[model samples]
Structure formats: C-alpha cells, structure tokens
Target: MSSSIYSTRRWRKLRAAKLALQPLCEPCSRRGKLVPAYSVDHIKAIAAGGDPYPALDGLMSMCVSCHSIKTNARDNPHAFGKGWKAAFKGCDLDGRPLDPDHPFLASSEG
Candidate 1:
C-alpha cells in the first residue's frame, strides 16, 4: 500500500472499474454469500512483491467487513496466520464444488 501508487489517477480508475465489473464480495461469494463489494483488493499485496498496479486477475472486490478482516489478518500473520484456509476446506481437494452432504461442509456449518 504505497502512498505514491495509491494516489495515482490510474489506480483510481482501475479500482472503480474493478468494483463495477464484479460488485460482490469475492470471499463471501466463495462461501455462498451475496454481499455487495465496494473496495478493490489485491490478491497479492504490493508488500508481498505484487505489482503496485496489477491487472484484474490479481484484484478483487470486497465489502467493508471482508476487507477489514482480510487486511487485519494480513497485517498480523502470526495471530491470524494461515487459519483462513480452514474456511475454504469446505471445497474439494482442487477447490471444486462438492456434494451437499460432503463431510467438508460440516467444517463451515458451525
């Protein structure tokens, strides 16, 4: 989150365009929710060697709550760590959709 890159007109336009293109919280979508997204996030953050201005593939739209949680987790990896993966364990090995009664679904039900 460099100030210089974030302040550019190009970044602003891209953010707006991305939000319009996919107006749903990406993380929520994967979990079968329909939250509207208002912020664009980088899948690979700039601090993690991602491009300062990445393309659509590296970007996602997210709601304020989702954004805050993700940012907080990322900012403090040790506390949150990689526990986020547990949330996605509902998917198949390759992240494919599984049967409704799939055992993995139980992990997310609680």
Candidate 2:
C-alpha cells in the first residue's frame, strides 16, 4: 500500500494523464534516449509546499531509473555524496552531454 495521497482517484487520474501526455521519460528524452516513463513526479514536492494538484506542466514523467535517481538525490543527498547531481554519464549522438544539468546546457555569455 502506498501513501493516501497516491492512492486517491484524483492523483491516479492525474498520473495517467501525465503519462499519456509524455509516455517517454523526460530526462531520458533530454538525453536523446527513448525510455518509457513509469512514474509521474511533482516538479515541486508537496511536502515542500507545492500544490497537491497542479497543472500538467507542474508534473514530470520519468522512468523507474530516472525517478529513483531524482528521488535519492533530493530525499537522500547525504547518502548519494557530493557528486550525486550529475550521476548520469555519457553523451548523446551529437556528442552533447546526457545529463540534463550538464554545463553544456547552461547559457553561456558571449
């Protein structure tokens, strides 16, 4: 059994809608990978004062692997150590970084 919030019909509908909207994992897609998403995560955690049911844009679709990585990094930072943020390695077909937070994606001033 999961938490009450997760078991609610509203939450279920929202999760389903989000998954339908983005069947592929957002992070994986950014990495140029075509992995199916198995989870719908809140962009801002409800425990952190985020809306319990925000718009679709406020949610993220993620595969089990990406979801676990994000959850661990956010909920158990100490356990993951200092280098937890950039846990994903390797590059896309264009040689661009696979990690969404990679410096290559950052805006560079001319």
Candidate 3:
C-alpha cells in the first residue's frame, strides 16, 4: 500500500499501545521500577541509517528522560550503550508481543 498510509496506521497503533501501557513503563519495569510511561522507544532510529518506520513493539513507553537516555545509549555505547546497558537500553526484544505488530520492530524496513 501507500507509505504515508502505512505510517499513519503505525502511528495510531503505537500511540494506542503507549496509552494502554500507561503507569507501567516497559523501561521502568525492566529496571524493577513502577512508574508511568510517557515516551516510546525505537529499537533502531532513523538516524542510525535505518528505515523511517514507526517502532512497533520496539515502541516502549518510558519517561521522557529515559527515552532520551535510551536513544543516546543506542547512538553511543561506552557512555550509555555499554555492555549490559546495550542489551537492555540498546536493542528491542525478539518476538512481537502482539500478532498485529511484532514485539520488536526493526527500524530497517527490510
């Protein structure tokens, strides 16, 4: 279908998921914290030489600061994307949580 249409649908689903996961931020849950999630994360970013698709399962709800820090971690390692941090803060989990959208959406289209 059309790319823009796809983008719109993707955005809606992502936003819906974020709203549903409110008060249970994935990033925080992973860290053993229970805080309201506000920001969505992209497993791969547009600037990382990847596709321009909205993150699906990769779209995790986190605080604004956590989201920024995660993005920074993806962009830079030693500082934020270090070893274990890279594993948690870097890439998205495998196997899509929902059948409609994979748990982890790759920034790359292919």
The RMSD of every model to the true structure, in order and in angstroms, is 8.0, 5.2, 7.8
Instruction: Report the lDDT tens digits of candidate 1 across residue range 2-109.
Output: 757878999999898888789898777877789999889876668768787788756878888777767776677774634344443455445854322235543555
Query: What are the runs in model 3 whose C-alpha is more than 4 Å off?
Result: 1-13, 21-23, 49-51, 74-78, 82-110
Ranking by TM-score: 1, 2, 3
Q: For each candidate, give its TM-score against the true structure.
A: 0.72, 0.72, 0.48
**lDDT of all predictions:** 0.70, 0.76, 0.53
Off by over 4 Å in 2: 1-3, 80-84, 88-110
Q: Write the per-residue lDDT of candidate 2 for residues 1-110, one digit (tens) a residue.
A: 22568888999999999999999997788777899999998866787677778799778899998888877877785855433356566776777665544567544312
**Each model's backbone clash number:** 0, 0, 3
Ten consecutive residues with minimal summed lDDT in candidate 1? 97-106
Quote the positional error of residue 26 for candidate 1 in Å. Answer: 0.8
Compared with the true structure, the alpha-carbon lDDT of candidate 2 equals: 0.76
